[model samples]
Target: MYRLMLHGGVHVLEGTFVNGAFHKPLFFFCQTTMSTETDETRQSLLLEQESRHTANQHTHTEGAKMPNRKGPSGASRLKKCIGLFFEILYWLLTLILVQFWKACTAVALSLMLTYWLWGGWATFCLMIAALIGIFYNLQDSVLYFPNEPESSRLYVPPATALGIPFEYVTITTPDKVHLSAVLFKQRAELAPGVPTIVFLHGNAGNIGHRYMNLHELYAMCGCNILAVDYRGYGKSEGVPSEEGLYVDAEAAVNYLHSRSDIDQSAIILFGRSLGGAVAVHIAAHRHNRDKLAGLILENTFTSIPDMGSVLFNLDFVRWMPLCLIKNKYFSIRKVSRIQVPTLFLSGSSDELVPPKMMQALFRICGAPSKQMARFEEGTHNETWRCRGYFSVIRQFTATVCRPGSNVMEPSPSPTPGPSLADYLGRVNMQHQDV
Candidate 1:
């Protein structure tokens, strides 16, 4: 029997060799034929592989020579266009609603003011005020622009964005609304008399909106910060009302006061814009006036009516009866009663709240020793960027609030104080069965 084996396309025929002589010449011929066939097959395979490799290279080169388009794909562009259209439509609808709301509010206010101008009695004014207060119950929805994250919206936590050590505080207001706040602790051991600033932010946005302010306070002002979001803002619960916000501010003050690490007497209430009004309201309250060390108001307006007047450039808005307004942050009336050492800071070129209004507020401020810092050519948001912003605060704070100093009493005034009776009457009227 003869055996044939194939290895790497090499053919081998094995047989007993008769003294180095071929047993069958045919066998040798067959083996040589097989070997030749195997060599030819191997060559064909190599040629085939080479041809395939060349074809692949040619195809790749052709693909590479094609035009390079850098923008989005046609499908992606269509999608983006659709999304933009929807966004525009949504804003358009929102604007229409806002315009309608404004029209209604303006007409109502115009009539009330017109009547008051035509010798409307206090009783008639009170009736008009009640109706206006009910109308503005949804005012928060219009005023507050919360930075709530959804879709492409951006929101960064205070600790991460501000680059400061902070704690998320959940405060429950007396009305049982859960409010979100950020408390930035001092890095070093706080000096005995050094204070913490309870930062009350403006009408719109959350506590995180004040990250720059908090960062500056932490780095330059040498004061720890505790900033709270009002109801319906950020993570806070409930709708915002004038009284509800006051309760929120009280809750913040109380939270800091409860902490053993904090100096209750050294706590300073710092407010900017609408927050300035909140701080003034809190400092003016009978209970909180003696508790807080000082008040720092920056670029704040007098009241809502005054704000509407300035914002709209309407002379009639200024003449509107303030008692009829709900959500009245009447800082002008309240500022005159806040006896704590106060600092009134404003930008000379503030567009939102006129510098003159801040000056008027400073003039009427009942604080025993108050200082005014004006940044010429500074706009509303740019007040802190003004020169000597932090220095002025530090200097003013040092004199007014030493750790061991006694709480100052409210200075006696020759003129009668602003009455909250009309304001409270309006609020109570809203709750009455009508």
Candidate 2:
């Protein structure tokens, strides 16, 4: 009948008085032995845990001291080397293409002119021949300015960035050249038989440069627009030439004809500057003439030879034979054959192309319906920024391209503005004063 009890953290053994002192002595011995075993087991566990912690610390310290022995793979090194080689090659080619040829031509022309000044009549004749050859070869460089402003060829900002939904398209010319283009459709559901404009830009810059104009046209006119970059411009392939540009325009129109979203019968061709020449060609040609609903020409020239006479003030350059000119746009000759509704947007203060040329084109245009909008303070490049530029275009398209619309009445004559000669005279006077 011995009983064990805990008192103040000590184990006490108690027995009834009947068992006497013998039970107490045996229970006490048993309690002491059990406490000793428990203490030993606790100490052993603490020692084992401490030893494990120390081993783990040592392992981590050793790992920290080790270094990574592996280097970049052979494939990585090869790729870097190839990239460097191509970069060097690209710069070298650029220098040769842009600077070397130009430098050589300049030196050659200087030497030839020096000889012509001091030598006999035979030398003069040879110099003339050389000049003709040089002009012929370099005409493309002077006419096509896709690289002007430097940034034009480098990057073209996307239409989507301006919140205008557009489709980036590639048009293949009949000659197998690829051209870059953008198709912008109105966000709202268009009514049946809505018109589409084939936007042809000037010689310099790509389709992206015309984003602001395109945006305004799309929003204000409420029409579908397909803006295309001609050959050798933007992302389009092949060199730019007068014939090549005409081909590019034809290809763009043909592309529209193939599309289901576009209304082929309501297609309009809108061109500015050199593009105006291209548009006139398309509108006059037998193939595309009947398919077009309207024509829009802005700040465009008459012909390459006419522009040369205006741009080059020297008597010798102005008097040069027109046959020497290689890229003759000859828009004046072509405008007489256009048989569709036409709109002429003229900048009175235009310094590049004479306003008279635009007026002449409008007068002679064979289109049954036509209108001329004159912006008095507008310049060659800034005419599109004029206050009533887009409104005039919107009005023309609305009146001309609407279904069953037969309005062929000509617009009233626009008031004449300052001529290019007057503008240039003022410029010269200002420069002389300065």
Candidate 2, residue 239: Cα displacement in angstroms equals 1.4
What 10-residue stretch in candidate 2 is worst by lDDT? 425-434
User: Model 1, clash count?
Assistant: 0
Error of 1 at 391 (Å): 0.5
User: Candidate 2 has what TM-score?
Assistant: 0.66
Instruction: Give the TM-scores of the predictions, in the order they appear.
Output: 0.61, 0.66
The residue-by-residue lDDT of candidate 2 on 89-117, one tens digit each, is 99999877675445234444554767757
Worst 10 residues of 1 by lDDT: 425-434
The CA-based lDDT of model 1 is what? 0.70
